[model samples]
Target: MTTDPRTLIWSKSSYSGNGGSCVEWAPAQTTTGIVPVRDSKNPDGPVLSVPTRSFAEFIAGVKSGAFFAA
Candidate 1:
């Protein structure tokens, strides 16, 4: 079954804080091996569908501070 990205329930990280810069992802869509992501500041913007494994790796990188400013 295919689900519409717009109709999927999206979520933001709890660690996102109150910052306006945050991305939302549809966790429910992960069951299909793909996750739909969109900018919280621009809900109507384009959606990026990433593979579940790739998305998990990205999350791991974030948690490990791999993207932290030098």
Candidate 2:
């Protein structure tokens, strides 16, 4: 990660709540074949870059509630 960063226009996920369950992604970055994800409260922190395909899968899992165990 460089101190001089690349541009990222992050948009919060719809699932985010006011209690601070926030997750943001850059749709523009994903168009370049990489997805940048970071905490909405920590914009200057580390960013996780994922392939577009993997990002889609992760989103699908989230919508399907696969991350929450019964």
lDDT of 2 by residue, 1-70 (tens): 2222247567999988886768888887766788888888787887888889999999999888889845
Cα lDDT of candidate 1 equals 0.84
> For residue 54, what is the lDDT in candidate 1?
96
What's the residue-level lDDT of 11 in candidate 1? 97
Candidate 2 lands at a TM-score of 0.81
**Residue 62 in model 2: lDDT:** 85
lDDT of each: 0.84, 0.78
Instruction: Assess the local accuracy of residue 48 in candidate 1 as a C-alpha lDDT between 0 and 100.
Output: 91
1-70 per-residue lDDT for model 1 (tens digits): 2666668898996666686568898888888999898888788888998999999999899889889755
Q: How displaced is residue 27 in candidate 2, in Å?
A: 0.4
What would the TM-scores of all predictions be?
0.84, 0.81
